[model samples]
Target: MNIGIIGGGAIGLLCASYLSQHHDITVLTRRKEQAEEIRTSGLKRTVKGETFRASVKARAGITGVFDLLIVTVKYHHLQEVLDGLSTLPRQRILFLQNGMAHLLDLENWDTSHSIYIGVVEHGAMKVSDHAVNHTGIGVIKWGAFHPEDTAAVRNALNETPAQFQMIYTDEWKKVLEEKLLVNVCINPLTALLHVKNGELIANPAYEYMMKCAFEEALSILGLAEKERLWSHVVSICKKTAANQSSMLQDIVKGRETERKAIVGYLLKKAQAQEITAPHLTFFNRSLEVLEKKQTKSFE
Candidate 1:
């Protein structure tokens, strides 16, 4: 398949590097400098302390359409990118992201296109223009984002590289809900506290607080009745204990974290249902303050 990956951040470049072995890859980005740097050299994928450069077509703009267009931008940036790619390939479009799909209204995107929501545990960060630091490798769960085109997505992923075989059921909502619970628990707390995730484990107070946040999200998702939600949230935090989530990374870079997309979205849902979201409300307020302060600093 000719794959056009939107957004050349860590995830985008890494996916381009890996999937290129099987499919023809073209990395699209609006960031001209990053795109130029990658085209001049290549992608340096550093995983497990070793690295290699994988050469692929890197460009700033994507014209016409592709057989597959995998959108991987941050949640907040999706709308703009989608609008830019208004003519995005109608077939084999995959959404490999982390967090919830609260960007509702995409169902009208394309009735013929197979929209697949994939969750990646692949830990990667852009160290330089052409370098990506992959902290860990894990499974990717994908499934039909639409009700009827399920088989199309299934077969497309079935023939993908074995590494991407981590593709599983398209129970996208459940997968997203599961990830949202974990993100609520760890992301904001880590970003606000300015600590690596691993450090949070040793602090019992923060650990409990994180657990509380997770429970808050679960309650909002009706997962409070499920015992597995609790265990899953705790386990992911412990597993990625030492890592700094994208939320924290954004803070370090003086950029706005995905506070609105993650916690704010949950709070909105609870508000619509007339349910209390005290913790979420508190976190959103605090993060908003931090964002404002950070913005003023930049100004």
Candidate 2:
């Protein structure tokens, strides 16, 4: 299978390296230098203290058609990527963006293309343009966005390395919502306080704030099993104690965070539902301030 992976970020490099083992992989990057570097040095992935390299075709922009196009770009870049995709021939696309905001854009997507939504559970960091560090090994759960055949792509992806797992499910929306809930609980607080995930649960005050955010998000999402969901969020914090949340990383690097996609989406939903979400509103406003500060500092 010829698999085209858009976005040369951490997740993109990680997928290209692992999936290249079983399939022909082509990585579409935003910069010509990065694409040239990848083509010259190959895609490098380090996992569990061991490093591996896989040769993959690299290009600066979208080119040939692919059997499967897995988009690993951030939510903020989805619109730009979709605009580019519109010119290409129809193909199966699987979106691996973090927040649910991209779903709104997909509603008006070209119906001729087969669309799929997925949540990536793996933790990865880009070491360089052509290299990535696989911090945590986890499965990617995905489902067809609309009724369509997925057996070929599913079977092809599942045959890869054991550590890189692909799971197919019919309830992809629930998976996304649960992931969003976890993000809402941890990301904003961690980003604002500049703390690691463990500190959120380790500090009493921080833990209380996280709970407040969790309760608000749970209500806004209208998800049942409050206790169970809260426990899951806490467990994630414990599991990734030493690691920084993606939001925190964005803050530290002075890059734009996904506050709009995750928190902003919830805030809008809260408004539509007429549910008061003070904590969420506070987080959103605080993050906006921090983002502005970072931008000014960079300037």
Candidate 3:
């Protein structure tokens, strides 16, 4: 399969490095310098204590048709990417954005394209423009957004490398919701408090605050199995106890966090459902303040 990965972020580099081994990979980046660097140096990936390089085609803008286009850009940049995709020939697209907010945009997408939604469970950090560290190895779970033939997606799933496994699920929406729940519980709190994931469960007051966010999110999402879901969130905190969340990293690096996509989505849903979500609302506003502060500092 000839795969074109959009965005040169951590996830993008990670996918390009692993998938290039089996497929022809072309990474479309936002900056010419980054693209040139990738083309010149190839892609460097570090897993555990070992590092390896994979060759891939790199360019600044989208060109040519691809058998599959995997979009790994953050949600905020998705609209621009979608606008660019409108000019291209129709092809299968798999979105790997973090939050469910992108689903609203996809509702009006062209039906000629087969759309798929996925969540990347792997933990990756961009070491540089052309390098990434695989902090945690996990599978990618995805499913068709609408009723369509999934043979191509299934084939890609099966052909992936073992360490970079992919799973085809019928309940992709559920998978997304569960992942959102975990993010809701851990991300904002960790960012606000400047604490690692374990501290949320380790400190009683922080754990209570996390539960408040979790309960509000579960209510807004109207998901059942409260106890099970709560347990899953706690388990994630324990599993990645030492690591800082992507949200925290964004905060520390003075980049905009995914507040609008994750927490803001829930707040909108809460408004439509007439649910009181004080914790979610607080997290959203607090994150906005921090984002503004970071922006001002950079200026």
RMSD (Cα, Å) of candidate 3? 1.9
List, residue by residue over 185-222, the lDDT tens digit for candidate 3.
99999999999999999999999999999999999999
**Model 2 regions more than 4 Å off:** 294-299
Report the C-alpha lDDT of model 1 over 1-299, residue by residue, as the tens digit: 67788888888988887877777788998789988998889888888888877888878875557777888888878877767666644666678766675336366554455666778767778888778887867767877666664654456556665544547675767777877887888889998899988766679988887877876787788875467767776777788888998889988898878897789888888888888978788888888877677554643
lDDT of 1: 0.77
Error of 2 at 136 (Å): 1.0
Expressed as tens digits, the lDDT of each residue in 176-294 for candidate 2 is 99999999999999999999999999999999999999999999999999989999999999999988889998989888999989999999999999999999999999999897785
Where is the poorest 10-residue window by lDDT in model 2? 290-299
